[model samples]
Target chain A: MASAIINGMPVEITPGETILEAAKKLSVKIPVLCKHPDLDATAACGICVVKIKATGRTLRACCTPIDSGMDIVTEDAELVQVRREVLELIMSKHPNECVTCARNQNCELQTLCADFDIRHMELPSLVPDIAKDTSNGTIELDPRKCVTCGRCVQVCQEKQNVWALSFLDRGIDTRIAPAGDISMAESPCVSCGQCSAHCPTGAIVECDETQKVWDKLIDPDVVCVAQIAPAVRVALGEAFGFAPGTNVTGKIYASFRRMGFKAVFDTNYGADVTIMEEGTEFVERFAHGKGALPLITSCCPAWVDFMEKYHNDMIPHFSSCKSPHEMVGALTKTYWAEREKIDPKKIFVLSVMPCTAKKWEVRRSADMSSSGYQDVDVSITTRELARMIKQAGIDFATIPEAQPDHLLGAYTGAGTIFGATGGVMEAAIRSALFLITGKNAANPNFEFTRGLKGIKTGSMQVAGKEVRIAVAHGLGNVETVLDEIRKAKAEGKEPPWHFVEVMACPGGCVGGGGQPYGVTDELRLKRAKGLYQEDGATLWRCSHDNPYVQQLYKEYLGKPLSEKSHHLLHTHYVQRPTYRR
Target chain B: MTTATTPNVQEDLQRIAKKWKDKPGSLIMVLHEVQERLGCVPRNVCLELAKLIDVPVARIYEVVTFYNYFKTEAPGKHILSVCTGTACHLKGASKVLESLSKELGIKEGESSADKEFHLQSVRCVGCCGMAPVVMVNGAIHGKLKPESSGKEIVAQYRGK
Candidate 1:
């Protein structure tokens, strides 16, 4: 360890550590634009440049290695001028679109401009004359506001392993784009929304469905029903100024009612239905050797779309089940409408989702209404819902807690956990174990499937057979797990897992692309904690235990895999063209 | 399709994968190697390499399609990649791109019908000192004038 005096405070750091790393240990705030903790320091931005000593040599704190007896001045006058100049140069190319931008208050660049008290750019602003691309269905990109920070590129490539974006062209003409300058929809983007999630400016954002949802609510002829995903409860609170792990399920239900949603339903009810069909399919497949082993969950639309486009070869491994949201959409337009004596066309089924892909998923041709209408009329993100509440002049925090309407809203703890990464796998195991053994398993709390870990695997005895299961969240992690399976199959060995649940986004729906921004590892875990707490407090903790789901199966669908259930609940995958063949 | 037993090609891929297996950002390294060997990271190569490394082919495809460096489809005979870093941006790379687009008769990222040349632009190549740099088949040409004709560059490659 080397000791250094920074701003008159002595701090100890590892011998080879950078000055920025040492300062971070000492709890000193240092503004950095080009320096990411996970990436190599480019020092191109020159914003983290600091004064070394009386010698007046300014060095980039991020790139410079720490040495013994080093005297560092982080906020010297000369250093401030250089930093200000760097900021000015960055500001010159940046479009002054902050006020009306989606990331107006959340932008890091905007915050830095405020922190540095930079009133105007000394250089002329060179805003790019590029048209906004809204082809991706989930995200919009306005190149004019881009500062070419390459943070979005790094995050897409390094973290998510979905390098759908990069900087294209040389100096003055440089811009971020997919290969071939193709529209985002034309590109192999999975609609995971990670690029939008990491973007520091208004350059990228999830598609806003706020107006469409509002129109549905105000229509006197329409009966609008809102279904909230399990993850929304954990994250909706953040938009209302609540902490990361705050559970605001009741409050969310109340707000939806105030917003004129005739019925506030729970997607968890549909999640329970999903678990039954998926679990039963797994058992039947394992017995008959008819279906693909290690069946991958298709609840996450981003994962499904990614498989459809790139990994079409592995489509057989995916379970033929619609996501909980899509299932609820189908049920609302069919069974639920019949029970309520409401016309299918008159009912508008809206989903409050934590995923940007849900917006795309609801529009899928296979997820269409049997009554000649779209299954889900509209899907709005958790962030968009917050905007709607604010727009409606409703104070979410002070709103009286309310309950979701019965039938669809009556969901068990297992269904509520669909928010977190390993949630679906855990929910499946709860019902699978019960169905296999005709009794609940010895351990109801499956702790293995309840963390922020990228991938988790476990085995348990079910019906006198050992069933191996693997759970992977994040497309990158799914890649690793799939590779292992391929290698195993090549060796003439049976794959380890009988079932696999893969969520495209990290930490599952809780860390979805449509959630509030600035989510880190800590924030994802906090959100997961909230999901488990919701599970713990619920009266019923198993998917099979959800009486409403069981009633739906008995009264309407007949059984889990009945022909009626298959028509509404199940779907197939499509293989797409690859460059190789 | 002619399967000419290109053991060297397969060996080259394995060698690249081995070199980057333990490195940070192995995916990018693999992509760089694949692009270098094939002049573009073909989707088949990505699928095969992904299978070899035991990673999801989707991940390999995602990286190849995501980064501007990795070309999914084949480029024209002469691939021209222009750098558009902040330094190049200040030096009028857009005018150069516009001029190139007109001369090549194809927009950026597109190849001409004759397959003689493909024009594309990349982000910073870490050569900010050279305001406008263009790379053709791994060779760097620094400080290009914005008004330089794209046909002239293509002619030079054709001559070579």
Candidate 2:
């Protein structure tokens, strides 16, 4: 343990913990701009400078680790003055469009300015004349508002490893841009939006489509129905002053109804169907040796895109399953439309997701329109849905709880856990066990496939045969698992792992790019734990046990891999070049 | 003053990337060899190099644009640089750049649409005595007035 005195209070810290982390334990607020919980400190923003009482030198708290018996003065007259100067210098270059900025009241810089009592910038604005990039149509880049914090660059290059964004140029001319003067859409960008999640300002943001959804809602002939993803129920409450992990699904359903949606559905229902098809696929390949092993889950659209661009060779290993929301969209247009006695053309399916990739996923390929119409009309992020709720003047706190419309609404605990890292694998194993062994998993809870580790591996026993599996979250960590698979295949070894699950964002959907800002590992864990708690409380914990899913199979689809299920609930993959140019 | 790229830029990039594949943090080094072989790094070469190096082309562009040493495009027929060092800045170098920009219709760090003229600002070049100098294709024209001289020099280039 390391000992330190911060502001005259003695504190104990693990060896090598940074002053910022130690100060956090002491509740010493050290304002930071470029330090993100998910990344290493770039020390680009000089706001967190703290004075050493022993040495009388100022060091950035974010990067400086606590030394033994070191006395740190986090707040002093000189330190405050220096921090104020740094804040002013940064603010001088930032535009005065806070009122209209996407981050408005939530930006870290705006909060810092107010905290430091910075009335106005005395320095002239040298804000760049950089052009806005909306080329991707999923994530937007407003470079003029950037503060050179480097959080987005770090997230893009280090965490995501997609390398779609980089800090171009140097000094005053420094800016973030795609390589080779290409638009983001033409680059290897997966549209995961992890960069936007870690960005401290409005420099990188999700494309706001609240108004577009509102336009569809007011169309008299259009029957706008909404579906809420598993992660949104846990994270959307952060904007409405609810705790980070509070499950607000009931209230979200109510809010959608008040916003003119004709029906409210739960995406968890789709997730359950995804497991049914995917679990069957896994069994067909693993037990009967029908297709490739280790079968990779295709529930995450961002991972699907990444696999197509980066690891196209693994396409044979990808399961032909459409993501949960797409499943819901297809069902809403086909099954639900028939049951509700409405024309599919008159119905508009709105998906409120905790991801920016879903926007791209909905329009990824024509396969998404298997329902004979564009299955999902529009997909909005959790942040956009929160904005719409506020726009509707409905107090989420006072909103009456409501249940989703029945046919495509009910879900199991297996479906709800789809938001967390390693969750899809756990969910599938719980049901795949039944599909293969014809019995419920004696111990349905697989504790090994949990937590925020970059990569998690485990094996399950089924009929005296071992089923090996690996789960990976965060794109950078994905390379190792894929390389291992490649090496094993090259050596002609029996499959190293029988199944694989991947989620693009770290901590899975709970830490998605389109969720509320100020994301951290703690918040991810909290949100994931909320989903797990909801799963634990539910009556049915396995997708095979979802009663509504059984009804769909009995009355409509007939079986898991039936022709109708394959048409509406499954899709294929194609190899994509990283750069169009 | 030679380009590192050969007639087949992609083949050259593949060869260079293969040489540095086992070495970490050698993308910039490989790119240097590419830029040295080619007068300027082309878009397609960057795309091919990204595949060989297993990196996003965005990082390649970031590094290319950061250092003034790497050029992304071939030089224009007429090169113009307005020195913006201490001596020149003190003597209204910005106004001189503005006039040159207006005359040539090209901003600093950009080439004219016709690719005829390129304009940029440079640091000090040991010409303190000749403050406010404009270097045209390596020839120095010093002690210039910001307004009329810029248009006159541009017209001289246009006449050529």
TM-score of each: 0.81, 0.93
**Candidate number of the best DockQ:** 2
Two-chain DockQ for each candidate model: 0.08, 0.48
TM-score of 1: 0.81
Clashing pairs in 2: A179-B58, B3-B36, B3-B37, B3-B38, B4-B36, B4-B37, B4-B38, B5-B37, B5-B38
For A134-242, candidate 2 gives per-residue lDDT tens digits of 9888999999999989888888888888887888888998888776556788877899999889888999999998998888988899999999999999999899899
Instruction: Report residue A401 deviation for candidate 1 (angstroms).
Output: 0.9
Clashes per candidate, residues 3 or more apart or on different chains: 16, 9
- Give the CA lDDT, 0 to 100, for residue A149 in model 1: 72
Expressed as tens digits, the lDDT of each residue in B41-74 for candidate 1 is 7655765686567565545655565556667777
- Please tell me how candidate 1 rates in CAPRI terms: incorrect
By lDDT, who's the top model here? 2
